[model samples]
Target: MTRPNRPVSTVRLAGRPTQRSALRRATQIAMALSGFLLWVAWHRGLMRCDTHRAADRFAEVLQRLGTTFVKLGQHLSLRADILAPDAQEALASLQANVAPFPPEQAVQEVEAALGRPWQQVFARFDMHALAAASIAQIHRAALPDGTEVVVKIRRPGAAEQAETDMRILRRIVLVMQGLVPSLRRWGLAAIVDEVAANFRYEMDLSREAASVRRFADAWRGSADIVIPDVVDGLCTPTVMVQQFSHGAHLHGLPSSTAVAAAGKLVDSYVAQIFRDGFFHGDPHPGNVFVMDDGRICLHDFGIVGRVDGNMRRALVAFALAFVEQDAEWVVDAWLDLGLLGDGTDRAVFVPVVRALVADCAQRPLKDWSLSGALAQLVAAGRTQEVRLPRDLLVLTRTLLLLEGTVRLLAPEFSIIEAISRHTTTGVFDEPKSAASQRLPYELGNAAHALPSLLARRLHSVLRQGDLLQLSIKPDARMLSGIDRLGRRVALALVTLGLYIASSLLMQHGVGPRWGDMPVLALLGYALAIRFTFSIARSRG
Candidate 1:
């Protein structure tokens, strides 16, 4: 097949700022205003200092800051593994509802994005918004073809503002990384980077449309889920057209039905995250509704979670470990994901793991302190020099959101029970009718034996020299290079420790140290120098 060769333009020329840049600038201004508000709230005694309901105030602050900060808060709420429970609870209360932009402005945005007059696009377009949030607002419209649908239009300047907020957020995160040594180990900076990347993709409606299609394909045969088809040729980075649905939100269902629905939702969430590994990251009540036909209608495809084949396979083991409360297996899974300290004392980690498992097991399924336990373990691990992967934080975030929604809808639903049920049938054993009659131990044995058999056969083949092999020879220079790299790594660690200790001394009055403590301002410059020299020496 012959393909046409296209001319490539490599000249770097400054052009008009993109819509994304404008949106970012707006967001930065909004964030600055938000920070000022926070200062005013603190200085004027507007912020209540009450110990109780403190979480509510925190959520309010985020909400008042606008969409980007609220979303940031929502993201933070997921890391109950890092945040205090009350703080997480407060942040989680910042729902995805904000005042709607005016109908006149809404029309302008829609017209601007579509590059046509509103009348040309729709037979009847409602001026009043159906709902509104941080980034976009919704309007009911009937297409010229007479297909009734809802149009979701990105708020004017939203992209630019979001980009700006993200930049501000990145700056804040970088400062935190430099100032708080503990935060670096928690992978906070990497998390912000991931969020920034996702936000960029999310700002494009075409990308969101593709995500919807992918989701639909993944759940083609499922009757319990409803994914709307995108109105092709009409979608753009600023606007999306999709089938409109009318149904009661999940929170309004009957208690029993809601509990059942909650169970099913949890099942769906876990299956999507661990089994399929491609899931809607935003699953709040606002993004879900229960149709008359009993199917769950999921909306909002801006943020999502994904796991490759390797992570997917590891998740099966993680689920199994959670089911059995096996600390060793869980740690192994964490290690597989690069979520543990390389030089951590295994003995120290075991006690912490044991404590965490015991804490979770002691609580009721609906009340399980999984986040608290994970948070404690994570905090303790940091004390022993552990590092967690960015994905683990994302996983923890998803679990927190899932568990919170479940608790709100059904307090009696046990996460442990739900997980055990799924592990036995969904992951460990093949599904069967009346499967409750089967012994779990028997299923587990069967599952284990297959892998054991495969391992033995592979060992026999290796013993008989049936497998090909290769060996590499290393020269003296290579050995010297390896030794030098190791020494530089050791030096970097020592420098990091000194810099960290000095930072703490300068920030807080934490007893006197041997040498005069340097200013926190100088620590960052010192770290950059140390890191650069270490790398340069290693390369030399």
Candidate 2:
């Protein structure tokens, strides 16, 4: 099946502004954003202003500022902790609609990326773009063998522009944080750093290609969902070619088809998070399509999220607790997830969460909204100074986007019910019996090693003539401090081990390589760094 080419609005590519230096870029940003910054200072420091109006103006400025700022605004819209409801709503409306660069430029880009004439690669290449966004534009094309594919070309000067924008954004964040001490707690600088990283990832088409391949591998035999296959030997940093997915957008499907598609969508997402731990982060309506064969096709793999084992378990517990209307358990789950801040007032936080649970429980399945409820919970947490993990926030945004698409197809679809079914059906349930069966063997192994461990320790103490002196009074506070120190030491040791192993892997060229380094080595380094920061944060 092939999708018809649609007319896309084209504009002469007025490329990104080239700034000579960071200072020059910073100056330009200041001039562009001075009004909004001053308004924020006055509103926050002096008389309060209407946040809705302020949010509208902020969105307008971001939209006018170009791609990087629009992306930042979209990210900020997901932060329920930092923004008011009205502000979130306003920012959520920010779209990345832009005129497509001329087809000649796209042709030049593809030929350059391929290092060959365009006719050698494609039997037919559409001049008109299939779609255009801030980061890239998609065009319909066909291989020499007549295999239908889509070509995605990165926007000209996007990388340089993003780099410049991010530098200026960091400076702005630093200035804002210094001016308002309270802004430090919100981690504005950290947010900018994260946005910069994600933008860089998106700019690298090879990463998105890898993501699509990974998803396809994960769902290789799935009958209900379809992932487009990437064209091997064609993907590069600025260009990607993939099988063209053919289906009607979700809104265009018939009611029955849409409802079935909705069910498949919910099931696929549940499996992605609970079973696979990796999922498409942005599953908005435009990215979802209902196939003529009643299968669901997911497009756009640029943004995705991963759930670690701990987060998956916490989410399962949270879903079960929410289903049972056990607010205390919900709070416990959040605490277990390490979302509650040190200054969180449990007395107030509990009541707020309890009320939200009560309200959700009272509503009919069709009327209930998992995303809205979660958003409200996040907002409530914000009020009590609770902080949520970025992955959780991303998941919340994913659910919000999924719900909107689902509603268009099946207005009565119950996300809560779908979650409950998945959780209770052993899809996410751990095998308790298997763990119980392994307990005896684990204990026997531990018991067998205990005497050896004890002998070594005892011999060391005896050799040092400290065996008798080892007996000492145990103070509660002292023991607690020692326990904390021991945990930190263990964590530090593990982190060191990971770094060493990763370095060895990199040196030996072990495992699959991404770019210059081994993928596993890269993962090991990332995990090690995360642990290092965790240790630092705990000490602080």
The candidate maximizing TM-score is 2
Question: Which ranges of candidate 2 are over 4 A from the true structure?
Answer: 1-24, 40-52, 431-540
> Number of clashing pairs, model 2?
0
- Per-residue lDDT for 1-540 in model 1, tens only? 222222221111122446686566556555665565566567556655543344555565556556766777777765544566667766665655556777888788788878999999899999999877666778999988899898988777667666666776677767756866776767777667766676678778778888888887777667677787778777888788887877877665788777877777877776677656688877767777777877777888887778766676666676677667899987776556555446766666677778778877787666765545456666666565565555666666666667777776777888767877876565544324355556786788889898989999889888989677655799999999889889888877777777677566667745544366545535654775777686776677
RMSD to the true structure for each prediction, in A, is 14.1, 15.2
lDDT, model 1, position 508: 75
Assess each prediction's global lDDT (C-alpha) against the native: 0.69, 0.83
Can you tell me which runs of candidate 1 are displaced by over 4 Å?
1-66, 80-82, 95-98, 168-192, 340-345, 360-376, 382-390, 424-540
Q: Using alpha carbons, what is the TM-score of model 1?
A: 0.65
Please write out the lDDT profile of model 2 over residues 201-244, one tens digit for every residue: 99999999999999999888788999998999999999999999
**Lowest summed-lDDT stretch of 10 residues in model 1?**
6-15
